[model samples]
Target: MQLLEERILKDGIVKPGNVLKVDSFLNHQMDIEFINELGKEFKRRFADAPITKILTIEASGIGIACLVAQYFHVPVVFAKKAQSLNLDGEMFTSKVESFTHKKVYDVILSKKFLGPEDHVLLIDDFLANGCALMGLIDIVNKSRATLEGAGIVIEKGFQEGGKKIRDMGVRLESLAIVDSMTDDSLTFRPNN
Candidate 1:
């Protein structure tokens, strides 16, 4: 996690409207080796949990979730932002509002992938207001899967998402929690 904090300090860009652009490394143009390190850390953090599947939202989270799933030796299930023709049968659906896109989407996943017998670990690139994550949690609830925990690469600690998720009794691990952010500077909450 220290490594991730250092990387954020070095490469993370602070934009107006509380956006932290980590596209150059974390999301857009990924550094596989670096992200692989993250996968290892997540495995170590959640080593005790009986994780059967790794769930994540589509787009930015897919790559990270795949990498992390390798360590868990589990399949990665992502919620699609849009309905596709390839999808069939009963599906779990939830509404999520994107903090970055400023829009809402109906995220969907097939029932064949998740069920009451499995334990799920949620993974994502970032957690802002908790909407996207909340949507995923809803789907997990609908599936009746045991929610083990969540592994987030970065969290806006200054925002309400982290507290909200924790308040709900969900085990949330965020590698880098940015407590404060500005155009010229940023501060991270101390992690032990």
Candidate 2:
């Protein structure tokens, strides 16, 4: 995870509203090598779990999920933020509040992809308010799939999302747990 922490320090930017911009190597302009490392780390952290599938949200989570899916040798299922005509009848839906976009979205996942037979590992690029992960958790619950754990690249430790999920007995693994950030400075939590 040092590679990821270093990347954040070198290229990440901070906004006034507590957003850490990692578009340079994560959501936007991606670094495939670093992404692979993320895959490796996630695999290492959750190695003991029987991960049957990888679940993530669309757009940003796609790339990271794909990379991590390679390590798990499982399929990646992404929840769509917008309702699509391509969607079929059977689906699981939940409302997710976006901290970045400052709005709520009705995220949907096809029922065909998730079921009681699967053990899901949720992955994402960031965790702030726990809303996004909660929406995914809701879908998993509805499908009756066993939740294995969660893999997050960067977590705003100052926020309650990580703590919230952990409190629910979910094994949440965040590569870099950032405590806070200022104009150009960031404070990260020491590894436990």
lDDT accuracy of residue 108 in candidate 1: 99
Q: What is the lDDT of residue 161 in candidate 1?
A: 95
Against the hidden reference, what TM-scores do the models get? 0.98, 0.98
Q: After superposition, which runs of candidate 1 have C-alpha atoms over 4 Å from their true positions? A: none
Compose the digit string of candidate 1's lDDT tens values, residues 80-138.
Answer: 99989998789999999988888989999999999999999999999999999999999
Could you list the CA RMSD of all candidates, in the order they appear?
0.7, 0.7
Model 2 lDDT tens row, 1-192: 788899999999998889789998999999999899999999999999999999999889999999999999999999999899999798999999998899999999999999999999999999999999999999999999999999999999999999999999999999999998899689999887
Model 2: clashing residue pairs?
none
Q: Which consecutive 10 residues in model 2 have the weakest lDDT in total?
A: 183-192
